[model samples]
Target chain A: MKTSDFIERLAEALDAESSELEGETILDTLEGWDSLGHLATIAMVDELFGKTVSAMSLRRCRTVAELMDLACGEVTP
Target chain B: MGRVLEAQGASVTAVAGYVPQGRLCNEELSSRYPEWSAEDILRKTGIRTRAIAAPDECASDLAFEAAKKLINREDIDPEDVDLLIFCTQSPDYFLPTTSCILQERLGLSTQSMAFDLPLGCSGWVYGLSVARALLEAGEATTALLLTGDTYTRYVLPEDRNVAAIFGEAGAATLITKRSDLPGHGAIGPFVFGTDGTGAEALIVRGGASRHPQKRRRLEMDGPRIFEFCLRRIPGLVHALLEKAELDLDDVDLWVFHQANRFMLDRLRKKTGIREERFAWRLEEEGNTVSSTIPLTLESAVVSGQLKPGMRVGVVGFGVGYSWGAGLIEWTHGGMQ
Candidate 1:
């Protein structure tokens, strides 16, 4: 999947506007960045990337770029 | 001492399930938890109503009802059943074992073999394997595999996560020596797996000896459990197909544990099984733990979705984080 698509999905999962998110955006600061968001992110990654991002690795990601890195196996261009 | 590698000739002769009279519909649940609307619950979980057990009912009671119905419907004499296997996580008693009680309650002969196999979710498949093993070993001929769980008993009213997903039910399956037919139905070439590491993902961590006095209600990590399913199910399905030497296209039906509609849809898409081939019956009865597969199998048969000679791929996953998959050659006519 495209990096842009991934970002858009991450924004959707977090219930934020795509324009409001960037690689540096902090995850927990978002209103919807709770367990449901976490689950949605996992499901989105699995569906889009056909890969399971390690939940542990996912939790350690504090920013958008870090999540993209883990989910995409390094941020896609 | 003698044992044979070939599983003895066995076929599922009858299957029946019973759900208690009580029902907790999505409307009622949403009224209680205003944060979730009835539409959202049904749209997300594919479950609109959940069967709840009566306050005084036990898993054994549910199992007995199902078993009695099966025995009468199949016209099998209780004395003819030489082996009885009751699979449940909620047994009537931890001491005497629930199967012993069932053997008497169901009126099997005193000489019959009876025992409890405490398992959840993956239990019916596991129970089938055990009964087939015993029958093949000549330890028992006609066998009864009973799966019942009142998991609602473990659900606390406050926890909507599990309460929204689980339903109380029981199923009875009769396994007997295949009659003299050239192409008789068979259940086997099974693939089973267990990951104890995932135990905490869905558990009631309080009542056991380790924390006997702490009595905590059932709690589930939805994300964690869903992740586990996402990771493992594809492999399990592939392995079972390989073991059976059948291609995915050869399977006439796919009946996975009715975890929920969302998970089933994901698994179907991930595994590439056709939507028409998949059994999606959880809308009316939420996840019924061990009874889900048998109950769904029977439902399919009664509705004519399953027929004689059809190859049905069945798998059960959850609870202990245990899973098993196998192919069943459907034989019962009218599947009645």
Candidate 2:
């Protein structure tokens, strides 16, 4: 799935509105986005792409776009 | 107490149950209990294998899974739950209460009533009674009934008395307004009674005014507890059936708290109820304290044995010499 589509799905999984998960919204800036949500996001990423994303890899992504880039294998950091 | 809730238009929007992942299957437990193989032990205890919560996992964790499953299914809005009753003896915190934490995690409204009932075995039935009453009294439109107990937290693993019996799990049900559904009935009269006098029969030596957590370890009088259960449960069930205007013959299914296979089988023989009437998951779930009844019922529904419109009698009896019985008029069919 596309990065935007992935972000939309993540928003739904987190029970947050799609608009709230748009680009430039730093992952840490989102309310109710806690450790559990972080773990869930990683799991969702693995489920969508038949591969594992390391916690170290997830930490490099500051925003949803960056996370999507990492998930798409377009960006290593 | 026995009006048909489903007949009044109420619907069960969701049902969920959870068992921890650290498995103690029949093969493993039988190795520890030499006289009994896992199968024999299951035959005796009505449990083949049981899931044990990790040291860090608490009752709240199991309840969280149940709530999460229900919410993920999008069957009912968390805010729609007006009452959240966590029936468990093992609360995550000694002071704050497990139900309160679940309320926050589930994002239930502050207006909801949240409380933890520190009871064992019969807790699910007691909770269902409370939920039904709340709905009937118009105290709330829907109630979330959750039961869980991490008993291993209180028991010594080496204590053969409880080790062979207790396991960990959680079960949840969304009880909504009563409606006139083909297979559902209002909650039945709950025949509940407690014999606090025999509290020590199956209790932790520590963790109360008497034993405080600092001194915590399970100290059970197994023989005495077995004797007490045998004597008390049948009479209790009889009383409950009479009160509910039901006879043993009228019950299409009997869902008993899986205290042990021996106790349940004996109860079945004594009650003159056929083996088919009982839903046995002991070989799979063991004695999950408060969650057993609901979990067994859920398992039966999921496995397709319990059909819709079946009149199921639920009996919970254990610790504190506490016991309760309730009738669940199946309004819906198999769990899809």
Model 2 C-alpha lDDT per residue in residues A1-77, reported as the tens digit of each score: 66578878889645478877776778887753543345446546645664455655666779888877777774333
Give stretches of model 1 more than 4 Å off. A1-4, A10-37, A63-65, A74-77, B1-8
B228-329 per-residue lDDT for model 2 (tens digits) = 665667788789788877788888899988877755665676566788788877766678888888788778888877877778888888888888887777
Quality class of the docking in candidate 2, CAPRI style? incorrect
Candidate 2 accuracy as TM-score: 0.75
Q: How much does each candidate deviate at the interface, measured as C-alpha RMSD after superposition?
A: 1.9, 21.6
State the fnat of candidate 1 relative to the true structure: 0.39
lDDT of 1 by residue, A1-77 (tens): 66678789988766679988888989988865755567678877888877877666677999988888888785345
Q: What share of the true interface contacts does each candidate keep?
A: 0.39, 0.00
Worst 10 residues of 1 chain B by lDDT: B1-10
lDDT values, one for every candidate: 0.85, 0.74
